[model samples]
Target: MSNSDDSRARDRLAVMAGIDVDNPELRRRLDAISARTAERLHQPVSLVSMVLDTAQFFPGSHGLDGWLAELHGTPGEWSFCATAVRTGRAYVVPDATIDPDQATNPLVTVDGVRSYAGVPVIVDGHVMGAHCVLGFDQHTFTPADLAELQDGAAEIGELLQSYRRGDTPA
Candidate 1:
């Protein structure tokens, strides 16, 4: 499918799955997950973000401050997590400042996001969003780190699926 078509389908499934971006309870749970992931990975920031058509929404986040934290999201063009969703795999940038694809990204230039790693959060065979970690300094992620990140993403997927089934409180 085309990128736009895939985005639309993912958005539809997110809605059908009852993923509420603004639900405080859900955000709390997601933030807990993000915090754990950040601590485990020794990263400064972590987020469970849903990549929508117009933006990437951070339903769960840790170690954020200022406007980005307040907004809980960024424009689609500013998302590193979107690459993971689109690829249905992990996307890693060891140093955004040196990566041609990421050099000019606002998150890199303005937000000082020098390193990033994200794994796709899949639910029912569809790519939903991502579980990602960020670092202000350049850092390379190992295979083990990717595996751990993927485990976190899987947990997020299960959490969302449970909500969709009404097996958990919203």
Candidate 2:
């Protein structure tokens, strides 16, 4: 997309609006979304990550090691969610080693991450984060897989709105 669009998207997340990452209720809802996403996509890792200017917070996640406890989030430079959020579309990287944009992404550590597919989680008409799945093999997702993820993202959007409205994410 255009730089203007990127800027507009960047301006919209409203992180200052305050997302309570530690909210147990929010975590429960996000966990369900992440688990379902992983199962539906047949990937080893699934994450509902908020792509802030500073980092990608894995509020809802699967497949993360203990490193996340030590570090609240992954650096933006190493965040695939950052690129996906900027694109405003589903970012499909079947093979990180071959994808120019993702080849250097830290998620592609040696035998760790080889595939990724993510849908932008647009909140209040702006990009806030991504609902994504990752794997250790070069697995190309089908169109149905994308549809499933997009549908899941819609649920996350609803949850975000509910959180903003001070309602239960359910």
Candidate 3:
């Protein structure tokens, strides 16, 4: 399929996932996971971000401040998580300032996000979104760090699946 076709399909799946961006209970559960991920990874910020057609929604977030915390999301162009969703793989930026693909990203140039690591959150065989951590200073993530991030992503995927099945996740 073409890129646009693939994007459309993914967008459809995101909609069908039925993630209520404003559901306080869901947000609280996801926030707990985000907080744990940040503590485990020793990162300054972590987010459970759902990439939609126009934007990425932060249903779960930790260590965010100011406008980002208030907005709970950002436009798709600013999303590092969108790369994870599109590729269905982990996306890492060891140093956004030096990476050609990330050098101009606002989260880098504007928000001072120097490093990022993200893993896809999948549900029902579809790439739903991402679980990601961000750092203010350049940090080269080890394989173990990625593994821990992947575990967090898996937990998020399972939670999303539970929601899809109309079951409250414990």
Model 1 TM-score?
0.89
Residue-wise C-alpha lDDT for candidate 3, range 1-170, written one tens digit per residue: 89988877866566546654566777788999999999998999999998887798888999999889999899999999999988899999999999999999988888999999999988767777899999999999999999998999999888776665455655
lDDT of 1 by residue, 80-148 (tens): 998998788899999999999899998889889999999998877777789999999999999999999
**Candidate 1 backbone collisions, by pair:** none
Model 1 lDDT, residue 143, Cα: 97
- lDDT at 113 for candidate 3? 94
Which ranges in model 3 have alpha carbons more than 4 Å from their true place? Answer: 1-17, 165-170
Candidate 2, residue 36: CA error in Å? 0.9
Considering lDDT, which of the candidate structures 2 and 3 is the better prediction for this target?
A: 3
TM-score of each: 0.89, 0.86, 0.90
Candidate 3 yields a Cα-based lDDT of 0.86
All candidates: CA RMSD in angstroms? Answer: 2.5, 2.7, 2.2
